[model samples]
Target: MGAAVGAIVIGASAGALDALSVILPALPEGFSLPVIVVVHIPPDKRSVLAELFQAKCRVPVREAEDKEPIVGGTVYFAPPDYHLLVEADKHLSLSSDEPVLFSRPSIDVLFESAADAYGPALIAIVLTGANHDGAKGMRAVVDAGGSGIVQSPEGAFATAMPEAAIAMCPTASVLSLSAIAAYLQEV
Candidate 1:
């Protein structure tokens, strides 16, 4: 809450169903702010997240594309097997970089890059996941003076991600999924 957020970035794994539940009603049609998401999937599997969320989300949703301009009122999910990054110019970039923590579309990669681009005007959220991939990323967001939110571990389907994020950034808000969704709606 240090600055008015112009963008939001969220990361999760082992959380497709949980993400769907929290995201569907969180964004109203035409809501401002570009939302970027990364939910890990096997590299060989084609990502259907954009299609899945686009059907249910009120705001426009699509998979992030290389060199694409980040648009307000839209949600862009990281494509599988690629690391999604936000350029200084606020364009989306896809890299076939080495995996971090065994994940190609690393939450850390996106969050850190987005923090560099948006700085204090970014909001980063870490949802349910099985690994510690998002912890360092959430720390980066907070260190950049952006707001960071972590799902309450008690309420998460897989608690490690949120717990690690919380450990990395103690000042981050810890909220239930419902609370997180409500906060998004009110933002």
Candidate 2:
């Protein structure tokens, strides 16, 4: 079954991820959609992203583990060196597949899988990034009946990723980071 209210999947590369700290805290407490963030991390080391996000995020934040069930009100980050996928049952699946767009925790892989799992119930968000990794998967989300959002290229630090997403899917909502957070609150 498709997600009933739609889920938001945030995709980004390193350079374009700075504003998340500010945007994350502004979301309302009653908002219950699960947010899965796919940020590119270096493969050679363990990621402190969960810990880092824990400081600013009002919701619980943790690194994704294999077979863990996805729950609302928690933030889940893809562990380094693995591709994170959303199962039809809404559990986490981690894979060591080859990198796409030179990223193991590829945003595209996560978005594509989530699109398949959630169908029209998914909402894909493309954030600031130096690479175009998310474009293809954002398209997949749209193709699968999910809504797609891209941060306004003018507001993004690295416009390539969001630009690519919007270029590929003309219907995506383009907003600033703060606005994106506000929009998520309504979800």
Best by lDDT: 1
How well does each candidate superpose onto the true structure, as a TM-score? 0.97, 0.94
Model 2 agreement with the true structure over 52-158: per-residue lDDT tens digits: 88887778888999999989877889999999999988898999989988999999999999999988888888888888988999999999888898989997888
Model 1, span 1-187: residue lDDT tens = 7468889999999875566557655788779989999999999999888887887778888988899999999899899999999999999999998999999899999999999999999999999999999899989999989999998999888999999999999999999888888898887
Model 1 misses residue 137 by how many Å? 0.7
**By summed lDDT, which 10 consecutive residues of candidate 1 come out lowest?**
16-25
Question: Quick one: best TM-score, which candidate?
Answer: 1
What TM-score should be assigned to candidate 2? 0.94
State candidate 1's TM-score. 0.97
- For every model in order, what is the number of clashing pairs? 0, 0
lDDT of each: 0.90, 0.85
